[model samples]
Target: MRNSRIPFVKYLIELLIVAFGVFLGIMISTYQNNNRTEKNIKKSIGFIHRELKSNSQKLDKAIAYHYKLKSSFDSIKKELPSDLAMENYYTQQAFRHNKVPHWTGLGMASMDNIAFESAKISGIFQEMDIEEVQAISRAYSYFDSYTKFSENLMEKLLAIDSNSKVADIIVIFEVLGSDIIITEQRVKEEIDKINSQLENINK
Candidate 1:
């Protein structure tokens, strides 16, 4: 009696096809995972770039404000006594002096605002060369100088009375204002440089 069932070779061939199909499925799954990982990395980079751009603009504005105040304070200092004399200038003098535009807040946002932001950004892009780190450091250095100047100015303000405090305040403001201006300028440069580097990487 002959075997009427399907041929043994046909059964083996069907089994081989199923195995090949499974292997193909696995390859496809791995390819998709790799693609998804690449997409995630790109998205993260895009987010970082946007944040840097926003921070750069803020830093620019801050720099402008600092310099504007510095220039006005410079004028005010010139108009006031050249030396620290016991004269109640700003208070009693009823001097219709134009308030320094930048001094409206008279609050220091120096390091926390820009330098720290830069540093944080630098951390985000560790793949960058040491030059980027140095650029960030330069920006931070400017901010540090500005903050130190601010601290010393506050000390000077406390050092004197109403009679002498006015001149001291003027000096402090002038120095701080200048430092702020320098910070703004330096940060701007660094931001541009870092952003350029980042752009190259993304591109």
Candidate 2:
């Protein structure tokens, strides 16, 4: 009977050992996966930060251009009726040749979204805080809306009859100038806020 009992004890020990080994393996796997996820989160954040930096620079130029355009429009609008009369051929011709392009369609630079796209596609956004995700989403939404507005404005300007009255053209220019002024300030603030958030994360 003692010999039989000895065999049963040995079997129990083997079963316990196998269970322990499986548990250890599971723990290691979980730890490795968590570490990899942490690294991915950090990498994704860094990528976003770099992309934002490039976007911020683009916005800087855009803001400056818009401001310049606004200034030009304001100056031209003041002289509108007098200039439209075309009493002096040379002066009228000079203004037409020099300022026509400024009043026409100006191209807007597209914002970069490589990192944002990648993060969304690869599930990196899942690792980010809900608030961070919302903030980034909101920023890009504004960018998209602004871009669409610009495109629509260009289309409307282009669609205008070449023989349209100077007063009508001036109205469009004034409207565009107003939009640019508002949009430029909003973009500046958004970029500055995003940059600040990035700096905080780095810290």
Which lDDT values do the candidates have, in the order given? 0.59, 0.71
Q: What is the lDDT of residue 171 in candidate 2?
A: 56
TM for every model, in the order presented, reads 0.58, 0.81
Please list the residue runs of candidate 1 whose C-alpha ends up more than 4 Å from where it truly belongs after superposition: 1-19, 83-98, 106-164
Q: Which one wins on TM-score?
A: 2
Candidate 2 residue lDDT tens string, 34-87: 899888878877888887777767777776666677788677656656757424
- Supply the global lDDT for candidate 2: 0.71
Q: Per-residue lDDT tens digits of candidate 1, residues 133-179?
A: 56545544655665685576567655655456454556567655765
Worst 10 residues of 1 by lDDT: 93-102
Q: Which stretches of candidate 2 lie over 4 Å from their true place?
A: 82-107
